[model samples]
Target: MDLDQSVIGLTSNEYVFEVERRHVGQFAAAIGDDHPLYTDEEYANQSAYAGLIVPPTFPIAMNDGKTEMPLALDQRRMLHGEQEFLYYKPIRIGDRLRCQIKVSDLYDKEGKSGKMQFLKLDTEMKDETGELVCISRMNIVYRSLAN
Candidate 1:
């Protein structure tokens, strides 16, 4: 796939996800986090948040095949470069979230592994009330086979 010409500025369809208590607990446990804010309902209710909260990386589970770039890049040749999340508010249980994903940037450069294409994607997540909750930035590198 010619990512530079095909993916940059591509905006994907919006996806909606429901945040359930079980999902929060499962994600926390999978990441080896036993924080009471995420695992214990009673403890969370007593805290400032007033309810169970999802972990910082809980957005990973929100990828339900609704937001996808049209690059058609090969998965085997793609490498995850970096990922960052900016949180404006905590993701609480029972909150329905919506995400709008976009391919913000795409470029090619030469690196130790030779020619590489960098694809930057951004996903904006909002709560059911339409309040911004978080933004996730993901960078992926596609190595050139001809290099």
Candidate 2:
């Protein structure tokens, strides 16, 4: 698809995710993290977070295509670029998080291969109390095959 500036501000529907002990432990295990905070309820209960917590990258698992882009782009031409996460609060078990994805920016740049369109998407997650939990920024590059 051509670079569409209008898609910059487009946002996806909000998705709510409930953090579960099983899910957190599984995610931690999948990543080979044996930290007690992620799996040991007794140990985690005494930590500063006061309960079982998820690994730093656990939010990636929470995103199951629930917040897809409002517009469709050719997957063949899309390339995953960079991802950044900013945490405002710790993600703990039993916390309900409401998340929505927004297209924050759309721009084009000249690459060694060809002109590339960059799509920046931001996922903002808030707790049930409407407090900011975290924000994940993802960058995608769309390159023309003709290049």
Candidate 3:
């Protein structure tokens, strides 16, 4: 079995994008979590957070657009295995956030089906003020076609 590895790291300076209230709203709608914290400002104020907040999983739910950090995952055989998030600060409405993703680990396993490769990604998110917000770990499993 041949194991090819790659590291994909990006800093906040490299990724020039912002997540606004509208984006948060759309994400909330798509996830079916129509909570006030994710939609209405007025309603959000009544909660623990002073303003509207984005969903916890919003950071990892981004569609694979050009803005996304490039990955070597074989898209055809890629599968979302697991995800874990660690939040240090609150992500509120009107707060701009940036994330840099990189390959944390890569390896191939000789599974019964075939040679399955695991690509582990670590995404660090921060606020405008250079404060760490959350760190998300994503695992993608790729199984080769040959048995």
Candidate 4:
């Protein structure tokens, strides 16, 4: 197994994101979720929700502040190995949020198929009150034939 990179932790491009009403609405529409909890405020209020709520997967709908991924890895054999999301609080509209993102465990391996890069990314999103709203983890596997 060969290691492609030695990145230690979160890089300079890691960042947070805030969800807005417009972005939530667009995401809801794109995902075909029109439930009262995601759309109509009155209906949401009657359903025990404080206000308009985005779908459970709404956290990823917006581009947010996440950017500047490390380009050191080979892209020809890139693949998403796994993904998971954990929510600490219910995401509501008009809530300004801050996010922290970091990269962890950068390594590589050589298998019968080819060369593969193993990477783990952690993203944390918090509300203005400093309460964690959501955290998403992404595992990416990159396949490339090293020279």
Which candidate's TM-score is highest? 2
Give stretches of model 4 more than 4 Å off: 1-5, 13-16, 46-50, 107-110
TM-score of 4: 0.75
What's the number of clashes in each of the models?
A: 0, 0, 0, 2
Alpha-carbon shift of residue 130 in model 4 (angstroms): 2.1
Off by over 4 Å in 1: 41-51
**Model 3: CA > 4 A from native:** 1-13, 40-43, 61-64, 68-71
Per-residue lDDT tens digits for candidate 4, residues 50-130, read 777788877655445446564455566567898878888778877766765667667767768765678876667778778
lDDT of each: 0.81, 0.85, 0.71, 0.70
Best by lDDT: 2
Error of 1 at 8 (Å): 2.2
For residues 58-81, write the lDDT of model 2, one tens digit per residue: 887777565677678898988889
**What TM-score would candidate 1 get against the native?**
0.84
In candidate 1, residue 91 scores what lDDT? 86
- Model 4 scores a C-alpha lDDT of 0.70
Clashing pairs in 1: none
RMSD of 3: 3.1
Per-candidate TM-score against the hidden true structure:
0.84, 0.89, 0.76, 0.75
